[model samples]
Target: MAKAVLLILLSAYVITEMPQASWANRPEEAPKEKVTNLQFYFHDTLSGKNPTAVRVAQAPDSDKSPTLFGATFMVDDPLTETPDPNSRLLGRAQGLYGSSGKQEIGLIMAMSFCFVDGPYKDSTISLVGKNPAMNPVREMPIVGGTGLFRMARGYAIAQTHWLDPTTGDAIVGYNVTVFQ
Candidate 1:
């Protein structure tokens, strides 16, 4: 009985250690990961005939506050290849930003970068985070995307390229890196 049990155990161990036969033709491997870097500028026009960004909401005390602490604006700003308004059009940034800081111009942004031309045509990337308006450069997270940028994750660096003190219009540059 003991010998029979030992033989059974040995047989099991031998079978487990034996190399199994592989498929005659293995399927092709999945596509490799891709990392993409994109640069563009947003033409945020506030007080023009055809405004891209417009004030949607505001608090009673917002007017009194220097930073417009409780103001919110909806934007459909044009995305350009360069800071110049006449530069090649890339897409649009459609979303909203609100003043979150009481003492400074801290904006909470939730927007999508919708592409219309080039390799990213019909794709969109979502960005949501706090933007320190006064900072020379601010970084925000690239949460996710759709179409060509599906399952994307990365970061975006924004710098104010130009500002109109009178109209409060601005051209902001964006550098985005994405991995999928």
Candidate 2:
């Protein structure tokens, strides 16, 4: 009988001393989400003294492939309210894109739009998708985000507002819809 009481006491102590990780902040349910629509422009500069994007690597056959397959570029482009680079600065789009299509110019983009202005300051939205360069418009997925955009899921429609054919510099307009 004494041994049974000691065992019960030990079990109670062990249960109370267990790690808190398994019990902390366990939400009973998901929070209601709000939908937001955002419009912005991304400036991808591949030329000039202060280019925002730079080629990082390429496959041996990248030069041979008209599509530049396997070529990768890291970018830190500016997000603006207008297609103009000098427009109101909204945020920065930082990430990497790689040429993945063998016959066509399909870019696998993985980037985050880090907002620096207004209510969304210090927040970010992550995007990942295949961008067909020749297409007039492309759609990308917003997988997730942080801060104000936590648990974000949505899509961004991209259209080339302007392109420098000779330099591959472009201003892409984005219309994004997000549920957070």
Candidate 3:
């Protein structure tokens, strides 16, 4: 199972397009190419007061902006060290997704992986994902970063590790490979 997951994550990264050169104007200082891999668990609670999941309407009328009537929310609370809920803190997944509505409206999202602990503590790895609402397996492009991950670029694969249908809570697995 682990091997299969790894293979899927790797392939996802290969399939996504690399960051466009126009996004950054600075020259490559250190190594032009470097790869870093990060595997962590994410817990998303959709039922909280400041819920991590929410539907956003572009206007008061739902029909006004169908494609823009999607949802935006956060994946901010989770255990990175272990799948267990009580594990040590790692960071947060600050994300937003949606179009107007439906499942196939050219879905996309910009998510920030903020690491509060570990070797990459206080750093952020930004990613842009397409087709975001299509279930458990999806690939996102690594655009840039801050702190230890400065000028980083790579891809991330997210898999549904577990979900609680009753509470709308979930545990997700993320495999991220970045070139700094």
Candidate 4:
């Protein structure tokens, strides 16, 4: 009885100390994810920035919260408009307001970044930003992606790099950092 009890304790100790070798054979562990960072320079034309007409109300006490807006834009290196398709392509942004009352501080913007040239041609990155005015340096979330940027998630810092009040032209600098 004493020898049997000692053997049982020894087996328990060995089991506790041994690493499960079966784990190694249960399919090689997935490759570690690569976190990558990428930047994009683009120019946006704010002349056509308008609220959606579908939700337009004419009543005196109607809810005036504009839910959607159209943002027309063109992407460029050094953010300049050029005829070269390699350096420039048409882009669009749809702003979805998330603020209540007449305050214009909080707004969520989902921008679809389309690359018409280079290695990521025809790829789109879905970006989301909530409450731009709440922080001094607003951060936008990278929700998803398509094509070469598959399963992308990161943050983008959008600042009004330059705004031309005369033509309503804005050079928005998007320092986009994405991980696929």
Better of 2 and 4 by lDDT: 2
Error of 3 at 159 (Å): 0.6
Return the lDDT, model 1, position 132.
97
Stretches of model 2 off by over 4 angstroms after superposition: 1-31
Instruction: Give candidate 2's error at residue 103 in angstroms.
Output: 1.1
lDDT of 4: 0.56
Could you tell me the TM-score of candidate 1? 0.83
List where candidate 3 sits over 4 angstroms from the true fold.
1-32, 48-50, 54-69, 99-101, 104-107
User: Model 2 compared with the native: what TM-score?
Assistant: 0.83
Candidate 4 residue 112 Cα shift, in angstroms, is: 1.0
lDDT tens digits, residue span 1-180, model 1: 999999999999999998865543333554667999999998999996999999999999998999999999999999999998999999999999999999988999999999999989999999999999889999999999999999999999999999997887999999999999
Model 4 worst lDDT run, 10 consecutive residues: 51-60
TM-score of each: 0.83, 0.83, 0.66, 0.55
RMSD (Å) per prediction? 5.4, 3.8, 18.2, 7.9
Residue by residue across 94-125, what tens digits does model 4's lDDT show? Answer: 33333332444455555577666666667777
Q: What is candidate 2's local distance difference test score? A: 0.94
Pull out the clashing pairs in model 2: none
